[model samples]
Target: MVDVFFNTWDNNRINNSRPIDTNDPTYVIVHGYQSTGGNPGNNFTPQAWMSEMAQNIRDLEGNDANILVVDWQDGANTLNYFAAADRVDEVGVEVADYLLGQGVNPANTTLIGHSLGAHIMGEAGEELRERRGEVDRLIGLDPAGPEFEGGWFSRPNSTDYRLDPSDADRVVAFHTSSTLGYDDPLADLDLYINWDDLLQPGASTFVGNHGYAHTLYNDLLDGFGFAQSNGTTLSLSTINGNTAGSVFVDTFTV
Candidate 1:
């Protein structure tokens, strides 16, 4: 279900105070690997971005959007990475089917996901195209790498259901956590932040690096002086199999 949350409404996704147009550009955000009930990094509970993300995007674009937050809490509540990772495939297809059933325009759709959620969007996009068409974008915020390293579950150039180029028209991956985040360029645009997992400031653990992807995305969208940073833009294909790793590109800015 699309748990629509707005500034006027409590996390319930319904508010009698205002009218939200369904025709607006939609942003469907899915949270990644988590355990239930405020377990800090292991939980998908509302982070700093959740509090103001929808409203902020709406205000920035000057449009009333149908911001759908897919809560796969039940599926993601396990510490078993394999189980949760398997569930991601199901959730991804289900979400894509939901959007199609609602008749949402694929051209205006943008799927934003973090970690496993990021790979979920890839699956969603691929399914959407098979059933409908390609989406505008699939933004991967530090996609998880543990169970997806070309192993039993995911393979780069095969039929495995890991996040790949075929998933969306424009797939963008933000690599903030090197060890945990996907080291390979899994999108049309792969953005490496802070030298690719050198450890984000104030990070007590490796998970902090993953969490910072959300922080960076939110801050960039909110606008800062470095939003228009000019840096060297290089192609991932030129790197050849990512043997070099850490492209050292500037963090993506909105």
Candidate 2:
């Protein structure tokens, strides 16, 4: 099961009963594999980034927006990657039901997920579309590639199996690590940061590289600025249209 935590504009964690205002935008953040949600920290160092990103959205949207953090640590923190991957769709349904019960408007909601959580959000968005049509935006922060893209498991070519353009009205993704993260263009607008190599600059390991997507995204939420890619200026603040292609961001030059 997935646990969805709510946050007020004051950044205070609240219970699920607080009615969400459908007029304002809501941001839901989901963490990836082998991680728990909270502040102190977890074995996965970047797990805490969820709270930071949620708070950043809270600060950006003020009292008008709703910020949600999803905890699927029970399903995620496991030695068997395949077992954990199998739980994505189940968790996604749980999340989608929670939002539906809360009366969250899909047109005013954005689902953001990292690694395996990205695919989970994809399933959630798909569930919402099946019931309510579509969501406003869906952002995948370095979606997991191992099983979803084809490895020791059966690779699914359908959008139903992973994050894709049909998941939301506007699907966007950021790729920072090609080794652990999905490198293919799955979103309507795919942004590849430091695409030339597997390891991102300043990242000593693949894990660190995988983390850059959320960290950089958190910064982008706080107006860290934009980058020029494929002759197009890209940033979170200016996401628009069905841009069906990949944009490479050379972090060193940007």
Candidate 3:
């Protein structure tokens, strides 16, 4: 486990503190392979990024749950995408093993994985399901698509290699980077924020839009009461630019 890093909100470094709290809900966050763990202007180290997200999630849970960050940076740093992708499976199994060893129930866990990490969580969830029979929920934040999507264009190891609806009881996904991300409806709730043009204000590249999934989810955690389309599906182009409050399908009501 030397190469893997797991942190929680109550105890930022779980390795140094008490066992994970099985009584409270658990959140596991996995970052993608395309990260420096550091961002410009923000200077966000991977740990720093997870810490902030943990705090936000804590707020969402009214400061009563466990937020864990699953980091596999050593393997993720590989130059070859295939090599990096192969490493996640072991990590997923290890993460699942740790939770079960800690006596944490999978039904109380919420796995949130981003990009490549999303698929990693799927693997972890699958591992848990195989042994424990089920996992609670999985949220894929713009799962990686380039080399993972199964189709005639590129051969995939398995469609289930990435996040899929079968991994957990509930799967919610936001396809912010449709062009470079999984285009299929892989989540129980597949959300597409502004599917057309794929022009995100932050940048012209796919990453600009990819990063916003975290931002939007963070906002939901922060109690922004993000609205879901009403009955009809939404076609939002820019999260901020759009003011069609009428399209709100649902919101975490206060």
Candidate 4:
């Protein structure tokens, strides 16, 4: 079943609208590491991130498009990477099954993930593709963590075995400040967006570090726009409010 964690405002407003309708595609957002509960270092509580993302999606797509923010109990632990990835796949299947039960077409659903969450999305897409058809879309936002560069981390290319070009009609991958080479494995995909080469003259060159400025968030918003417009790949500077960087978009038809 699709488990929905709505914002408190939505809960209190008590609208007559159904949280998710099968006729319309829904978005399931998965957050990155330290996004869960119980820590001062955490940017926002998992519930809060869910609420915020749901609100954003509602603002962009209105009430008809459903948004589900997932939370697993072990979301905060560092050693639970494998478990978390597995959970993402399980949750994806659950969401798809729920949508099917509600009469929603599998082709209409989309999965969006950031950082480690993106790896989770990849894993989920693979699992879902095995049972059902591919998901409508999978958006990866700067999807690499510390482990991704090292031998210990499970690379998306190696771990997510189902993101082949033949599986999905569209697969869009975006890299803002990814330390890993983002273009190699995905060059054959339908679309690839990158901004790593656009780093400012004096920008930090820390190895395996790409979390500079607010590039991550801006790239995500722009990526959403690009996906919706079916526009050509972009190579523009000035994303959000950051300067001295550029964005690139490339599309290939399979």
Candidate 5:
């Protein structure tokens, strides 16, 4: 059975206003870590962000795509790396089952994750590929955390199914960060789309330290088959003493 957190036409108020088709491709966005006091940092809420993305897609695509926001409170706390990793796979399966139930072909769905959310998407995508043979695309938006690095929370490259050399057609990762260690893992991805090449000239600092911005979200919206054109690609510079070795934007057509 699939666990569904939200449906667009479920409520009479929303359904009566606009009847949405459930057959559209679904996009799931997962959020990253919270701050020290167990509060959602930077006012970042997974559901809110997902809703915004959904609205943007509908406005741009004219198709009512289902956008699901996954929230795992237990995984948010510190020192629970194993549990967090497990939750990612669980959420992925749940989302996949939900999409299947809605009559949306698994091949049409896309999963997008940011920061630790990227790790979740990786695990989830692997599970979906192995079990359901669904989930056509998995986009990693600056997937950074202790798990990607060498630590007790580390997730080895072997666990990232999307990075497999043989399955090159389905996976794409975008790295956009001025901070070195934050976006270094993007280098190992199969199809890497660097934001350093996608930003407009003189548009240096992105809004948050590690959160979605207009530029990043616009790129995602465009990539997911909504908008015709998104943001620009700017040149990235390499700073010394950082984990990022070289920064360049290259598109992979598969």
Candidate 6:
């Protein structure tokens, strides 16, 4: 089952009350495979990043903002990658159903996901578009490429199966790991971080590189700037702005 947490961002509180302020910008955050919403025992404190990102969003938009964290641990926390991948569309449909039931305004919602969760957001976005309308924005952090892009198993060649520009009004993605993460441009704007070396600075393995997407996003939320080759400093505004197409950014540190 999927566990949705409505975060209040005050003392790590979770308010699951539905029918939140629809006018306020609502964020639905989803984690990737093998991770829970806020379980530390998974050796990866995904909840820590979620909380940090939520707090950062609250700081940017004040207390009126609504933050929802989706945890599909029963389906995602598994040893079988293909099985977990197969459940993406189903879980995404459920997520869409939940959001639609809560009367969330698509124009004021932003879906953020990492790895396999990114594809979940894509499926959810597609379902929402068909049921209601498209979301305002969809942020994909190094979308998983294993089963979807011919690694473990051959996936369908349809763009509908993966994230594309049609998923939302504004689709932005960050490609961090080429091996574990999707290498192709899967959104309106794809930002390739440390593309020259593939491995981000301070990341020893491809897994570390794959996991760094959320950290980079959190850093971007914290007002950290990434520099492009042409001496352009890309910030959160750059991602949210009217920029389109792939841009390369080199990360010098963690």
State which candidate has the highest TM-score.
6
Q: For model 3, what is the C-alpha lDDT against the true structure?
A: 0.68
lDDT of 4: 0.47
What is candidate 1's lDDT per residue for 72-114, written digit by digit as tens?
A: 6667867787788877778888888778877787778888888
Best-performing candidate as measured by lDDT: 6
Root-mean-square deviation of each candidate, in angstroms? 6.5, 3.2, 6.3, 8.2, 9.0, 2.9
Give the Å shift of residue 149 in candidate 2: 0.5
Overall lDDT per candidate, in order of appearance: 0.67, 0.79, 0.68, 0.47, 0.47, 0.81
Model 4: C-alpha RMSD to truth?
8.2
Candidate 1 has a TM-score of 0.77
Cα TM-score per model: 0.77, 0.88, 0.80, 0.59, 0.59, 0.90
The sequence of per-residue lDDT tens digits that candidate 2 reaches over residues 76-109 is 8799988888888988898888889878898889
Look at candidate 4 and tell me the lDDT of residue 1: 26
Kindly list the per-residue Cα lDDT of model 3 for residues 123-206, writing each as its tens digit: 889888888857787878888886788668767657457777788877777778876678777767777666665465455788
Off by over 4 Å in 4: 1-18, 37-53, 79-103, 145-167, 180-183, 187-254
Error of 2 at 173 (Å): 1.1
Model 5, 66: alpha-carbon shift in Å?
2.4
Model 5 earns a TM-score of 0.59
Q: Under the 3 Å rule for N, CA and C atoms, how many clashes does model 2 have?
A: 0
Prediction 6 TM-score vs. true = 0.90
Candidate 1 wrongly placed segments (more than 4 Å): 1-22, 35-45, 151-160, 225-247, 250-254
Higher TM-score: candidate 3 or 5?
A: 3
